[model samples]
Target chain A: MSINLTILGCHSATPRANAFPTAQYLEINNRHFLIDCGEGTQRQMRKYKVGFTKINHIFISHLHGDHFYGLIGLLSTYGILSREKELHIFGPKGIKEVTLLQLKISQSHAKYPLIFHELTSKESELIFEDDKVTVRTIPLKHRVYTNGYLFTEKEKPKKLHIDNINHYEEIDRADYNNIKAGKDIVLSTGEIVPNSELTLPPKKPLSYAFCSDTCYKPDIIPIIKNADLLYHEATFLADKTDLAKKTKHATTKEAALIAKEATVNKLIIGHYSGRYKDITLFKDEAQEIFKNTKLAEPGKVFKII
Target chain B: MSINLTILGCHSATPRANAFPTAQYLEINNRHFLIDCGEGTQRQMRKYKVGFTKINHIFISHLHGDHFYGLIGLLSTYGILSREKELHIFGPKGIKEVTLLQLKISQSHAKYPLIFHELTSKESELIFEDDKVTVRTIPLKHRVYTNGYLFTEKEKPKKLHIDNINHYEEIDRADYNNIKAGKDIVLSTGEIVPNSELTLPPKKPLSYAFCSDTCYKPDIIPIIKNADLLYHEATFLADKTDLAKKTKHATTKEAALIAKEATVNKLIIGHYSGRYKDITLFKDEAQEIFKNTKLAEPGKVFKII
Candidate 1:
């Protein structure tokens, strides 16, 4: 199985004519999730061919307008589309109050159940888990209450060696599950076969970490260590470290340093300040510390191996 | 000297790839105003070349998400643009609370003063007035609190008759203001020139009425009588009259009937339902009852004489 991420928007502060604010769509093991819906996110989803119906879960990084302003509009559109499936929302506290107030004043009755999971913890905690993957909150240091998410795929069952299994007469279709589960095949002749002879180890589980709108906090490196892919916000260049520190946002050098310390396989940087017209400077600055650095361009997709 | 209206969006419900929700920019006697900022309205303004700085006043018809969801985004953009002039907003009572709460959560401190005028009157009342134009609210019948605005230009000064002024020795440059103000010119030689002889009558004051998301209410006809141009929402066709009534929206026939009864100079029907692929059917249905009917196409500008 593979995890794919599509960059929906990656600009900072305000949406400009050529740039959009922060939004991303992640598809992991056939499950779709929307992360940090900024203004015009629904339109961006439509423009990028991402179906809203597939987005059952939405994670807001913070309450900032550039992070979650499109949420209300997206919910309203779901009502218009007559969506009946329950929607799951995970964000900081006060999201429910803000959203419900707008819906109440508008007199819009949602046809679907809205489930809210407000995160208030300042520590790393497991937020969601299922058979395929597990999700946890990575508490981040920002001007507001913010939490980044870490997704890790569960270990899969060992693969069955078909040729080895066929060579044994006792091993048949009925024993396929046991062989895949790393169990030895029991023969009627009372001969023992080790599990290593019939099965191989499961492929290494993949992991991804998303961090945005936060300062350079080295504490998170341990939680996100060895991730296959890590998306970090690089709001400013190293020359503007003072402004970045004042705003509690990370600079390109800081993001790259975090990725290097975490030993992540790949690093993607985005959320560029509106002042910088050329985004190439961010990639250039980030590559100074990390070799496998990439820019999170809108509509670009990243495949996690 | 001229009133121009540019239709930014006209679709009724959720925004789609091919259709946008309600938004309009009206330039009346050199005053620019924005009516009903739906989602993505700022982008539409940019696409239509409507300067956001010129729009000092914004009038929201209702609290519906399709009507005012774009307000907060626009306000944030203004802060990013460093607007120092005070911006005025006129809407229902709860608008200020809703808008301010979002701004507070986003930590967006406006560089300009945001003046809010909460309208609660159920009768036609002048909400804004200046030397150029007067704005009055047209109470509408809807499921929620809604108000349509009526903009009327104030009476202008008479135009000077340059040839007539040059022929008379007493009517020099000093007497130009008195002649334009409809005052008779009195000379030192005791020769009296009537105001009508020295200047021509001022052009007739123009008026425009904007109504949307309201039911068929005959009570507003008198308030908008003989309007130079009227924009009324026709959300559905005559066949969907029952649906329109249930939803508190107007049908094409109902909108046309209102325009005919009010004796408006021109009628523009908009807010077309997404179910209807061909908008020509709405125009045809409206024109059957009102001869001077037009469709409010996005980006189309209407000039009022």
Candidate 2:
């Protein structure tokens, strides 16, 4: 199990020539997902050479313009492209109304089924689950109702120990499925062979956490504990702690503190305020508390092996 | 008076890298106006160095995503920048509901007053008039209710013929105002001087007509007659005349034909369909019918001096 994340945009607030707003493309367990599509995200996707049709699910953190303004344009483009795959959108309440209204008014109706999964719960809850992965909300504190998301790969089936299986003549090729399913093999001589002896353990499952536009909240540490990778919003530096608090945004140090408390393997920080001319300051400040911190940039990718 | 028009984006349908949707910045008679703000228009304005604060009026041709998707983002950015000037948005019906609903749902209220001039008229009518310029809607035929705009500079006062005015010492400096107003000058000796003898006519007024996303409709020739410059949408070439007619778009020949029949001084064609790889084909085709035809490109400027 592995996760690959591509940062389509990472700047805060309005989009500029060189700096884009928040948007990320994540590939986990062979499932593609788009998070927080800001304006110009489609262009960024095109620039980064991301497979446009690979994405079947989209998760929006909040309704801020910097977070989700590009949604209508992308949806309309999908309609223009005549996408037939059903798209599932997980976002806060009112996303459906606002999106459908624009499409209806413009008469650019979608050719595919648009399923909206409105999230209103303030508690951590499972929002999506498939055969290979599961996604749950990491309710976050912000100026408005918001939620972070935790994506995890489901545990795979046990691998067969071919050498051990060779010792049993009763274990035919047809019994390999049972062995992989953790079932014991009953010998024809009325002897039992343990499944543990016939099968080896599967690889460990990996998890990714995405948190943004939220204040410094330690309550989320339990939910994101021991994640393989965590992307958190660091809108300000330590010097702007007061401003960060007033705006309900996290500072670099605050984000590092969350990373430390959550014990994630690596931390990716972004959603930078445009005031800072040098983004290296964010990486330097974050590294002071979390050694495994990295700064997010447009088109930058992070992978968990 | 002069008209300086900056084409922010000119491609049709969807926005792509190096190919933006329809948006233009027009500076006429000291008035700055933004027309058809598609997605990424704010970034285009920033890239082209168009003064964001100078635009008080915005004209939208229709509700298509490629025509006006960037409006809400721009309005939100204006609020973020603490814009104090009232903004006037002129578009078709349902624009207000769609825009206001987004602001309401996102809670991104504008600090400045947002006035919406909903146009439902199917006839030519004056929509905006100021001290120096007047804007009138030229009802267009399209898939949706669309209207092109005509911006004309009001007639300026006659310029004083300094050498001729000195011929009459009795015509004091105080009489200059009446002379410029095209009134006969009354000398101190009660001798009347004809206004034409004391003042020269002012520079000829300049007018610009913006027509986009419309099929060939000759009826608009009367409204846009003798325009100094005309921008018409030429989505396809003459080879795709059938497709153009079916899509309610105009071909290169059709746009040039309109420019020729309307007797406009110059013709600028844009909104090129993505199917054409070489935009020069549009210009070459248009120039075949109109000698003074120009192709609209991103950042291309057309001026009437």
Report the number of the highest-TM-score candidate.
Answer: 2
Instruction: Quote model 2's iRMS.
Output: 1.1
Write out fnat for all predictions, comma-separated: 0.57, 0.59
Candidate 2's C-alpha lDDT?
0.93
Which residue window of length 10 is worst by lDDT in model 2 chain B?
A: B13-22
Interface RMSD of each: 1.5, 1.1
DockQ of each candidate, alpha-carbon based: 0.61, 0.71
lDDT of 2 by residue, A264-294 (tens): 9999999999899999999999999999999
Candidate 2 stretches greater than 4 Å from native: none
| lDDT, candidate 1, B206-258, per-residue tens | 99999987999999999999999999999999999999999999999999999
Cα lDDT tens digits, model 1, A137-196, are 988989999999998888899988777877897788898888788787768888888788
Per-model CA lDDT versus the true structure: 0.91, 0.93
